[model samples]
Target: MKLLVLMSLVYLLGSTEALKVLVLFPYAVKSLSILGTGAVRHLLNAGHEVTYITVYPLKDPPTKNFRQIDISKNAELFKNDDSLTIGYVLEHQVQRTDPLQIQLVTQESARLTFENENVKKLIEDPNEHFDVVIVDLVETETFAGLAVLYDCPMIWLYSMGAHWQPLRLIDRATNPAYDPDYLSPAKNPLSFLERVDELWTRIKWQYRKTFIIQPEERKIYEDTFGPLLEKRGRTLPDYEEVIFNASLIFGNEHDAVRDRPSTPQNFKFIGGLHVEEPVKPLPKEFQDLIDNSKHGVIYFSMGSFLQSNSLPKPLVAELLRMFGGLKQTVIWKFETDLPDVPKNVHIVHWAPQQSILAHPNVRTFITHGGLLSSIEAVHFGMPIIGVPVFFDQFTNIKKAVENGYALTVPLSHNLPKDLKAAIDVMLKDDTYRKKAKELSSIYHDRLTKPGVKFTHWVEHVVRTRGARHLRSPAWRVPLYQRLYLDLIALVLASVYLFFYIVSRLFKKTPKKTDKKKRN
Candidate 1:
């Protein structure tokens, strides 16, 4: 029996072919990209083969099994659009009409057309098969039809923190589009007006999906693969079902200050999976300064896309002035030189963020509340002052403040005073430091590392043949059902009718009416 079992195990291991995964990561500035690299690393480590499609050079080279599909050299439609570039959009898309997401959708659709044409040309030789396609959630709807055309399993990865909009869409729930500001948990959950706003967002997205994304996608498919497939007399799969990739992997931790009612079975929380080893060497000057400064160091970075140089001069000048007055040595991550020099302040074009955050003398981080930076700070157990610029940064910073690890200051023309006030508050409060350390401990006290959890899920899906059992039924149910609206309305109507009947019975109506009729 032992010999037979060993033989069976070997057979199973040997028979399992490397899962051929087509990874779509058509984003720019790949160096700072978290989701693409994270997904690639985990998939490759698990013995799955990956074909990465992207517009930028892969920042960290992949393992042996990984292959590259170079869309980086192609620059016809998306070359000029800054917002279409992934790194710029993340830090800059504050307004809903901010052209980046729109341009992303436009370029993604076009790229899908190109990719499909390429695939069709290659498949004529008859040696291509893909087991699965994993795409970032943003443009999955555009190119996902190709996955269906190839008859492959599809998984959508949420590259950022979770929110109701994406979660609802993933599950096929009633899509209530909520604006970023109104969706905050800091306020009451959802007011009536806010609920209306959400409804409008849902309506708009649905319109765009049906009218905009679908027809454009259909035309592309019809043009490229359309003729070849027509020769075989087969129509492509419906774009909606093809576009909606069911499973999701979120780059967020459950313990983080996120508003999650329950974990969706199909959704995996692998927040810190993309964390990288410190690659860049620390500057000698910065190292010497750190060694010399007996007082603690304060590190400030606004992330990659948003230039500190672009910040209104008044605010910049004021910030420089304040930092110069401070006793502690300050390291500011800036793109260019400042006109005024503060003796205490040091500016570097790029700072080794993880290394500095890891430093023993680093007391606090002043940041833009980007998730990666916030996660690092939490990992290091350092206190923070968050000055959020846009998008989910506001929510992230707010959550951090609520969780007791940080103070938040709004970004505006008059930022220096607010920034100084926030800094002073964090510096003075020992409790913030204590809380940060405690939360950091909680963040780390997991059954395994986040990447391990991520890997397990990826393998689990492939092994289980797409793990359809794990998908949430919540998406299948309507919003009204989920909200229990029918039940509430029934209860209210019953109470109202009961009160009306009781009031009628109590009135002295019959006797007087009968006497008047007789007269």
Candidate 2:
């Protein structure tokens, strides 16, 4: 293929220096696939060997340079682990932001993963070695134990959308005052009441994380990975020590779409790293469908975890009717086939999402506001109608709406009506399309591709022997020291001491006689 030949040329001309890289992501869906592919592609192009462990196995043949370890059971966990369906989400929407949910999921997943036979075998092998470890740091930090086992530079690859979750590892977490939390309905530069809610939300989250989840996490971690650590002739590392010792933290964020936070040198934003050059070719039927639509095509997907067929039948029927009346053709990634789909609407079990977005005829995108999908929509100059589901999806939609390229319709009882209204506005407005084009320009205006940046940082971490100089000193500093609370206490104590000494001296010096006159 043309793409293969081009990549071969890049490999021949590019850096011949190689690394032995280990990527461990035991629980994920398309996130693991997308990120793992990106890391492997750039590393292989640079002539490195990658050992990737994942639930999703690579379909392509492994060359001498690229190898993979399959833990495909995680795929089932990711799919069936939907405790947060639409109705459930609507009912417990307020509690959905609880950090406990993320912690528990991560803890159990980590247990299932680290204890897997494949992972255990790899850990037990004394001859196995790697120069660097790249870990997917979403919903779990327990895998940092691998950093201990491998005794190599570890890079925390954070793919989740904007949140303090991964930031807590290498740097101080975001300030709740200005940095709106994913759980709270707030943005930066907030009002007094919003700030109160933000602070409270952060407090409850930290309280639960510290008191409830962390204890359980430590127990699970010790039980699952203690033997592996002992086998390596190392003691089990404290959770914070293991997670915080990362040489680099690669964040899947762009400042254009996220509220800027003060970040250390090691925390780099490589948001769209997986979007490849020459873009993957669209399937023939999809190419024809878009090419044939004179009114332009609209694309919709709820990401990998949630399926459209999971929706109530009546709601699905109503949405179909609305799509039936649309001028532009609709390409919906419906999970199951339906007999009564409208002529203008095309439904398929799977979609070539990125390729379809890149098409010239894509007029709009309806999404669940997943970060990758949002970024792709911006990349292809397609505006959005975001129906946020969970996690940072709401924040992604908030940014898109703020950036003037999208509108949001929260999932609720009236989702059909609300979605239709939002869709109508998207079709009527040229401003949204103009804004999308502008953002696409801004997003692409970077100096280098995200994939290259990721590769460079990974190599840097390995070359510098964990890149320790780049880590923030703040990670080691205690909260009281960081806040200068101890200094304040010392100052207050000194002032009181000074007053006490002065008063005692005055009394002891027979001030009663002269002090009465002095008083």
Best by TM-score: 2
Q: 20-138 in candidate 2: lDDT tens per residue?
A: 98987766657556776777777888778889888777888467877788887765555654455654575455434556776777777777787678887887788988999887886
Please list the C-alpha lDDT of all candidates, in the order they appear: 0.67, 0.80
266: Cα error in model 2, Å: 0.6
Model 1 scores a C-alpha lDDT of 0.67
Clashes of each: 0, 0
Off by over 4 Å in 2: 1-16, 76-82, 87-95, 161-163, 508-519
Q: For each candidate, give its TM-score against the true structure.
A: 0.78, 0.90
Would you list the clashing residue pairs of candidate 1?
none
lDDT of 1 by residue, 1-519 (tens): 999999999999755467888777654433334557777887787788887766654766765888866665444444566543223433464433432355345456455536644443544433666877776655335555546555666776665555554566456443343333222423336578766766666566557656666576666655655555555567766555555455555545446544544446776777666665433455787778887877789998888655677665666788899888888899999889988878889998988787787777877899978777778778778889987766456767777887899998766655778888877887788899999999888887889777778767666677777787887777677779989999999999999999999999897765544445554
Residue 516 lDDT in candidate 2 = 54
Point to the candidate with the largest lDDT: 2
Model 1, TM vs. native: 0.78
